[model samples]
Target: MNMALLPSMVAIPLGIAFFTYLLARKSSILADILGNLATFSILVISILLIKTRGVYVIGGWNPPIGINWVLDGLSNLVLVVVALISFAATIFSTRYMEQYTARYKYYSLFLLMVGGMNGVILTGDLFNLFVFLEVASVASYALVAFGCNHEELEASFKYLVLSSIGSTLVLFGVAFVYGATGYLNMASIGGIMATGNQNTILTVAAVLFIVGFCIKAALVPFHPWLPDAHPSAPAPISAMLSGVLIKALGVYALFRILFNVIGLNQLYGTLLIVLGLLSMTVGVFLAVGQWDFKRLLAYHSISQMGYVILGVGLGGYILATGGSSSVAALAILGGIFHLANHAVFKSLLFLSSGSIEYSTGTRQLKEMGGLISIMPVTRTTCSIASLSIAGVPPFNGFWSKLLIVIAAIQAGFHAVAGITILVSFITLISFLKVLRYAFLGELPEKLKNIKESPALMGVAQAILALFCIGMGLLLLPGPREFLLEPAVNALIQGVEYARIVLSGS
Candidate 1:
């Protein structure tokens, strides 16, 4: 089909990143227009890719031997999510970033990060995946410190340090794989590994890979930098970090490697379950105590990520243990569904928090009160996002969470199912604290003169809020078979991806 659009995904934003920095140096408005145009164009392209699938071998070289850009059920699913969130974030930044100077600089780094993430998703080479992951990670490190204040710099430094360690571990894992298989292409490595040849070296590589990606995912003990770095960045950037970044770079990578490369197993499933449970319980519990709006949202990112990890892990456990195919598919579907839902609503939550801060000049929930009347758009959109994340019906989150719990029960993991319910309730408790202290009480005297966020900011939040409401329809028959089923099949197929990818190549 339209194979040209594949490379253009990475190329377009990358080209704009450089051009905006140089040519639009003096014009913040020009930078904003250029950035929005780039992301919006990509969003249009990504949507058109709804039913498209193919592998575009780079430079006309044979794949499994040369670098390739592949589009399939899994990567295509992620591409739409990335493009949608990036477009909305760009729109929000047009107004939200006026508080800071040098919009050109922000736009440049922002685009670079987007390009890198696109590269990470599309590339078929494991080494190139690492390269692209670093490209995005490095750019994010700078963006976190864009404020240049003591807090921002400190947060950035912590992120850089931990992120670099993750990178080093990834590189070591890559080296181990290359040494074992003599190839860097993911398909080739998977093909070689599927020969049922398990060894100590491979085991070491798997451990390194798991730990490295876990760090990137910010799972539990590895999540210190997230709470700090996320709150330190601007709201749109915060949206990107919590919404898509961790999923693309962390959860997505971990799944791709474990399921497709090293192969999923009982041990891997158990590990995922342990780590996911810890992240889920710890994140929501800690979030209940935070008064900082963005910080609270940041912790929820970890908790939501745990849901994704847990659901997928459950699916993997079922598959590895020879459980029912339908049940395994349901669990994986739940995880992937949550991944997409979280991307939109979490981004909206951050944008809404940005709107509130834009109006009230503060982030403390205690400092905000009765904003529903004054900033109705922000309050309404924010409430939608809150309920969506809390698993309210007719919203995307509820359907996915329902799938996860049902799958867990069907798979005979009653305790895991119960834990999922516990996490959901705890999440509600955390958000209730948010609603009570921020939107339900009396407006402070100082905030009475405050106004709502600008039109563009409201537009961004509204787009995501609508998705928060409408995403539940993805679970309906037609859309479910067309969209969600492909993703589930990709994971269910697992290492067979090597065969599908090679045949297409």
Candidate 2:
């Protein structure tokens, strides 16, 4: 519960990144061990802090001026997801990354990404949030091209240019907010906006913020870069990008700013729903015909995020319009639950794709067949992940998707619910194609001798797959109250975000 633990969530990985890139560069093994150890340590810290809360001022500075790290239910949840996924990726990378040269630099960048996400989750100042967002974004651009091949370089370059534009726009929004409010701390700016005195400048700044985040999150109109970047990164880095990066930097940031800081209203909520609908419909249709395993999963990332956006946006709408409290809560619970589940299953799917590429040296589904006979673990885990993402019963995805659908129907958005159900059906069909071509069809003669993935790869993947199945338990009354309720309470609390952090109680 000590506030001191919060900074280490970012500090430990950053320190490891520095050390690994310098003195540990001579030995890939040392860098690998150090990177995984740092992630694991942060994982333990994040787990311990799930029940903890408070605010810590950096440099003994007070709020409204000094930088503060806010720890609440929502941030705690995000930190855990970031640490857990980063740990699994590092473990998988231990063996899979051996193919690449300069692996020390890879681990360094990997850790740097972890540190940045942690910083983004915990920072309470708008300027610090932007700084951390750029940190994570820059590291990811480098990682997408880590292989240094033509495709990887091209993809990373596209990702960098587009992401740079998004970042510049975000910085302009931050500057505008500061200029309008004379405050860079989230709570102070929020408190000012809550006074109902927000002017045209603030409104324009909010539009810029949404524009920047939507691009970062890869919502449909701004989603062109993700298909390339997600598939182009090294598998573990791909896992980080698809699993939590978009959610952390995009969805979560959007909710915190729009809901808690700028204050969500009818206009913002309606825009979110429209965007979510487009992303869900468009992402799945494009995914259905993809032959590349990672690329298919990349498109699904956009589709899956639509569910999260819809749920949370619905929640914001209900609150804005004075709808039922329980309905709003249900919608947000769906959003947060789906966000957590996707981080697990999506990472597993990507890791499985990586394993296939590792053993067979290809990512195209048409070139892979009867993997079940050669790589049972990869095949089995991939099946579990595919099923989970497709919303098959008793799997993690089913529960979250069900919650969102039920919430939509109860809120009288019958059309939205229908669209959701249709999306699930299409998602199932898409994954079935992946399973049929990649794992179930006739054994290709070229892949007759393919072997299972490395032990570490299997272990890391199994960790995610197990969570994919067991994740439904978090919805139970017991775990739900403990882990999820606090987060739901935070979002529903809205302007109370300022009071909680400002009081530091």
Candidate 3:
């Protein structure tokens, strides 16, 4: 629980990443072993720090001056989610990456992305967050094009151009924040902004931050690149991009700054709601028509993220307008809970998609049939994931979506609540198309000899599948307090985050 261990969350992965690339260049097995071990280590550290909170000031220099890493309820939650998905992806990649030439290169980039995400989660300063964002972003750009095929290269190029614009906007936001408050540390700037001091520069910075993160998160209207990138990359990378990368570098960063640093206002809250509604409606409507398997999931990723944004936006609006604190807390809780739930189920879905393509050599749903007979393990796991994402009962997704609905209704947003349910229904219908075409009906002659995915791939899917089934238990009082309440309390603290960071307690 030592706060000092916080740095290791970022350090271990970065160190292992370079070591893996160098030492395992000729040995894919060594790369696989090193990659899994690194992610598993970070996962363990994340769990141990679940009950811990403090700041690690670098080189004995105090904050407002020194660069620091923070361990708190919110950061801990994100770190755990990132570590969990990274670990699963590494395990899945052992067999999955054999389709590629240099497996070690994949692991190296993969761990670098993991390290960058961890840094983004743990950093207490805006500049460092931007730095880590680039680390992750640049690595992802290369990864999308790793296959060296025309399709992969084109997708990676488009992703690169759009993502570069986002990064530039984020950098400009950072510069503006520093110019406005003369501090790069988040808690420091937040403390200054908490007072009645207001200025036009900060407002512009806020706008830039919103747009930048919207692009990174692949929210609607700003989500041109994800459809191509997710389907082009290797499946494990696809899972990472949808499951945790966007959350860590996009939604989580945006909200932390809006709620904690700039201090949410009625205007900002309304903007978030509008964006959320747009993303939810547009993403799903487009998704329901997709025949390419991973492409469908990619669009769904945009829609599902809208649920997170809507829940949190509703809560932020309530707080900004001086509505009931309890209702706001519930709404935010639903957002964060769904954030965690999506990490598990969506990752399972993408990994499951990988399993199918690995066996059958195609991603088109109409080209697959009666996979249930040839690939029982994949069918069961994929079915569980599909059900979870569609908000079916007893799955993690159902509980979180239900909480968002109840919270929306309680907050007097009946229209919003109705739309939420409607979207879930639409989501269900889309997945039904997947199940009907891919798992049921007549067995396609080309797929008759296809087998279930390799055992390691199945194990990876099973790990996330168990989480999908059991994560609803997170709503229990004890677990909620242990895992979620602390995060809520952290965001609820708002400007008080400065005092905690400055005190290093």
Each model's C-alpha lDDT?
Answer: 0.91, 0.92, 0.92
- lDDT tens string, model 1, 1-505? 6877788899999999999999899888899999999999889888888788888899899866789877878888898999999999999999999999889999999999999999988888999999999999999999999989999999999999999999899999999998988889988888887788686777888888888888888989789989999999999999998999888899988998889888998999999998899999999998989999999999999999999999999999999999998999999999999999999999999999999998899999988889878988998898889888999888889999999999999999999999999989988888878877888889999998988889989999999999999999988899888688898887888788888889988
Q: Cα lDDT of model 1 overall?
A: 0.91
How displaced is residue 248 in candidate 1, in Å?
0.4
Candidate with better lDDT, 2 vs 3: 3
Tens digits of per-residue lDDT for model 3, 1-505: 4776888898999999999988999888999999999999999998888888888887778778888888888888999999999999999999999999998899999999999999999988899999999999999999889899999999999999999999999999999988988999998998898785698899999999999999999998899999999999999999999999999999999988998888889999899998999999999999999999999999999999999999899999999999999999999999999999998899999999999999999999999988888898899999999999999999999999999999999999999999999999999999999999999999988777777889999999999999999999989998999889988778878777887787873
- Flag clash pairs in model 1: none
Clashes of each: 0, 0, 0
- Tens-digit lDDT track for model 2 on 200-310? 898898899998999899999899999999999999999999999999999988888888888888888888888889999999999999999999999999999999999
Off by over 4 Å in 3: none
Worst 10 residues of 2 by lDDT: 189-198
